[model samples]
Target: MDPVNLLFLVPAALLAGFVDAVAGGGGLVTVPALLATGIPPAQALATNKLQGSFGTLMSTWTFWKAGQIDIRSMLFPVVCVLVGAAAGTVAVQVIDASLISAVIPFLLVAIALYFLLSPRAGDLEAQARVSLPVFGLTVGIAVGFYDGFFGPGTGSFFAIGCVALLGMPMRKATANTKLLNFTSNVVSLAVFALGGQIIWWVGLAMAVGQVTGSFIGSHAALRFGAKLVRPLLVVVCLAMTVRLVANPQHPVYGWVSGLFSG
Candidate 1:
């Protein structure tokens, strides 16, 4: 990449990391930036994952150090996410993603509304609605698969699941989300790397920005707790929903196209 184009990615990656650390729609920014650089779609996706892995890892470390994530307790969910992501990566090649893509925007709207309308949401931990095993199988594995397959709003989905199903506070939810996000990101990044899809120099430059921004964002989340995370999660999810729904390849967009054509 040229110096100008490469330089443009730094700030974009930084902003993405900051948003991702808080609410998880970082790819909503970085992936578009990579595509704007005129890389092929596959390379753009691969490079975005490469940079995203760094930001997620930084956020996970920051959360872990803050005593938010208990690795021992989370081990099962972590493994579930890893396995789910790997499966999703393979499945995407065979399955049509339109069904899931069509549903995600509506799901995001519901999640956003639940957070917005529920006064007690993300405020404090309540009794979990599901056991750890069930949560791991349903939310953890499902979201992990979604991350590897479609991936626009994986963080927001995880955060919502943590708050609503797992009954965790926003801060802890954000911390745990990072762990799962990092796991899925690493899984996808490795596959992309093996496929020779990543643009290494570009990925590395953006990764530096991602790490720095993620560090700052994670600390901010720890300091501000629910106050910062809740609103940001809503915004990021809605934004991702809009992005996906507007995509020409998305099923919803295809419906829109048919409407206009008719």
Candidate 2:
């Protein structure tokens, strides 16, 4: 809220937006920054989403304007996000997220390994494998649930889902991901604000930076197309998975997370 905080946040937001636009892990950057400022974790997540919405909106708009996204039928996914996330948020109060945390590393590892092994997985800009409407509905519900319940690495989830199910190119998948992500974030933001948890000034400062960073990052994706996008996504997913497994709190932070136990 102060000038010093604003100064620190501006840079953080811009970098967060750029990372978000590039690979869908901006929260990995912005959430920690918010937490570092002594905010509660819930408020930090809510405010980060508040600021992140601006960049995502810009990224989505850029994709739409460039003919990279099919917006007319995007409503189903967007709406599903709003509904599914509301439910997920409510359910979280009763459900333990420990299982999800335990499982997600394996999921990320599998996704990363798939991409790493198959070099041509999403490289071809061919006809989509699924109908637009069905495609939209499937991912909307599944990812909406995830984003609503536990939201780290959501961008990666959407990206891989689009590629694996719809056979969409990575560039287009990233664009569409932003639109769907925006809807989910908006739903969560509304809830957080309702609970009086969002830090308005912090969200505001970060939002401004999000717009700037997203514009630049969006253009970069447009320029490089799927060739650059898919591999980078795989790498990011792998990195995020490793981070999750390590938990940053385990005795063997680097090596032991791969060995799983029931």
Candidate 3:
């Protein structure tokens, strides 16, 4: 890459990591930046995984260290996510994604709306409706599939579901999101590596930026209450959903098309 693009990747990855840490859609930023590099779609996606996995890992660790995660209860869900991601990746290989693409905007809108309507409850004082195992498996299977197929609002979905359905606080929900997000990324990255689509040098550079951004983002989340986080999450999801609906694509993903075209 030239100096101009190299410069761009740093800031792009940094910003992507920060937003992802705060809300969960860093790909909304990094994937387009990769596409803008004029690489192939599969190649860009592969390189994105290479970089993103690192960012997710850093965020996951940060959350864990900060006393946000409960690993024992999370085991079942993490495994479910791994299995679901593998299944989704395999299914994507055989089926056209047009149907899911058509439906995703609605799904995102629902997620955003759910949060909007329940603003007063379910952040810190929420209660779990099922055993940890049951809850984990449910989210793991459903969201894992979504991540592997269409990934615009995966983080947002994970965060919100844990908060609303499982009655997790926003801090705990954010931490748990990182863990599951890490698992899903691991699945996708493995496939991309096997296909020889990753650009390691660029990925490593982006990872540096992502890790830095994650640390900053975690601090922001810790400092600000969910009263602040709640709306930002909704707005990001709304923007992502609208972007997907108008363009008839994955919304957040449409930016990738522009990058390659430009």
The per-prediction tally of clashing pairs is 0, 0, 1
lDDT (Cα) of model 3? 0.82
- How does model 3 score by TM-score? 0.91
Q: Model 1, stretches more than 4 Å misplaced? A: 257-262
Enumerate residue pairs that collide in model 3.
244-251
Local distance difference test values of all predictions, in order: 0.90, 0.80, 0.82
lDDT of 2 by residue, 1-262 (tens): 4568777787888987877886788877788788888888889888998999888999999989999887777777777777777777787778988777667777777877877888887776656667766765677777787888888778888888777877777788889888889888887888888989888888988899888888888888888876677677777777777666657653344346445531
lDDT of 2 at 59: 92
Give the higher-lDDT candidate: 1 or 3: 1
Q: Of the candidates numbered 1 and 2, which has the greater TM-score value?
A: 1
What is the Cα-based lDDT of residue 180 in candidate 2? 85
TM-score of each: 0.96, 0.90, 0.91
How displaced is residue 162 in candidate 1, in Å?
A: 0.8
| Alpha-carbon shift of residue 153 in model 2 (angstroms) | 1.4
Count: clashes, candidate 3 = 1
**Candidate 1, 1-262: lDDT as tens digits:** 6779978999999999999898889988898998898899999999999998999999999999999999998899898998889989999989998888889999999888988888679889888999878888988899889988878788888898889889999999999999988999988998999999999989999999999889989999999988888888888878888898788878888888899999
lDDT of 3 at 173: 80
